[model samples]
Target: MKIIIISYQKILFQGNIISIIAPGYCGYFQILKNHAPLISILKNGFLKLELESEKKKIKIKGGFLQVKKNMVIIIL
Candidate 1:
């Protein structure tokens, strides 16, 4: 799946990934390819992604997450 992370300053990340771990309002959630669609609030935490053999992590100030059409759009 593809993941995009955006912040008010700029677009933080855009790439293909196997999974993502982010802080949700209720708790932390992991998103994987072909995961069910969802829209949830985010909390301050790290946004972790798996790209092939690489694992990337970025800090997010908390925002929102939307999953659809095999895409994960994170606003933080």
Candidate 2:
């Protein structure tokens, strides 16, 4: 899946991933390839991205996320 993360400052990240774990408002949630369309309010925590060779994590104070057609857009 593809993901783009943008903030007021600039685009934080844009990449392909095997999976992602996001800090949801209620708790934390994981989105893998072929996830259903969704929109959620995020919380102060980290977004963990599992890439081809390694894993990465991005810290977010808060944001909104949308997933559709295997694409993820995150706005902060």
Candidate 3:
């Protein structure tokens, strides 16, 4: 799936990811390829991204996320 993470300053990340773990308002949730569409409010925590054989993480204060049609967009 394709993912993009942006903040007020700049785009933090934009690329293809195998999976993602986001800090939801209630807890953490994971997104995988072909997963159902989702819209969620994020909390202050870490965002994990898996790309191929590599894994990456980013810290977020808070944000909103949308997932649709294999595309994920996160605004922080």
Candidate 4:
């Protein structure tokens, strides 16, 4: 799935990811390939991304996330 993370001043990340774990308002949640569409409010915490052979973590102050059609977008 494609993932994009953007802040007011820059694009933090844009690439294809195997999976992702984000700090949702209620708690942390994971998104995988072909997952159902969703929209959620994020908390101030870490966002984790899984790549083909590596994993990455991004610190997010707070933001919103939208997932649809295997695409995830986060705006902070």
Candidate 5:
């Protein structure tokens, strides 16, 4: 799946990922490839991206997360 992370300052990341470990309002949540669409409130924590080429992680204060049409968009 395609992952896109954005913020008021800049576009942080865009890549193909196998999974994502996100900090949601309730708790940490994992999103995998071919997962169902979802919308969730985020919380202050690290966003981990697992890709075929590399595994990356970023710290974020908070953001909105949306998964739709095999695309994941995170706006902070």
Candidate 6:
């Protein structure tokens, strides 16, 4: 799936990822390709993504996430 991570300052990441794990308000959750639609509040923690070649972890202050139709958008 394609995912984009953006903030007021800039776009942190924009690419196709195999999976993603993020810190949700309640806990942690993972999103993979073809997964169901999701929307959630995020907490201060890390956003982990599995790309084709590597895994990346990005620190987030706090934000929210939206997933739909194989696309994920994270605003921090």
The reply for model 2, stretches above 4 Å from the true place, is none
Tens-place lDDT per residue, model 6, 38-74, is 8999999999999999999999999989999999999
For residues 1-76, could you state the per-residue lDDT of candidate 2 as single tens digits? 9999999989999989999999999999999989999999999999999999999989999999999999999999
- Residues 1-76, candidate 5: write the lDDT tens digits: 9999999989999878999999999899999878898999999999999999888989999989999988999999
Q: Candidate 3: lDDT of 53?
A: 83
Tens digits of per-residue lDDT for model 3 on 29-49? 999989898999999999999
User: In candidate 3, where is summed lDDT lowest over 10 consecutive residues?
Assistant: 29-38
Model 5: pairs clashing at backbone N, Cα or C within 3 Å:
none
Cα error, candidate 3, residue 22 (Å): 0.3
Clashes of 1: 0
TM-score of 4: 0.97
Error (Å) of candidate 4 at residue 24 is 0.4
What is candidate 1's TM-score against the reference? 0.93
Cα RMSD to the true fold for all candidates: 0.9, 0.5, 0.6, 0.5, 0.8, 0.5
Report the error of model 5 at residue 35, Å: 1.1
Per-residue error for 28 in candidate 4, Å, reads 0.3
Candidate 1: where is the Cα deviation over 4 Å? none
Clashes of 4: 0
Would you list the C-alpha lDDT of every candidate in the order shown? 0.88, 0.96, 0.96, 0.96, 0.93, 0.96
Clashes of each: 0, 0, 0, 0, 0, 0
Clash pairs of candidate 4?
A: none
Question: Model 6, clash count?
Answer: 0
When summed lDDT is taken over every stretch of 10 residues in candidate 2, the lowest stretch is 9-18
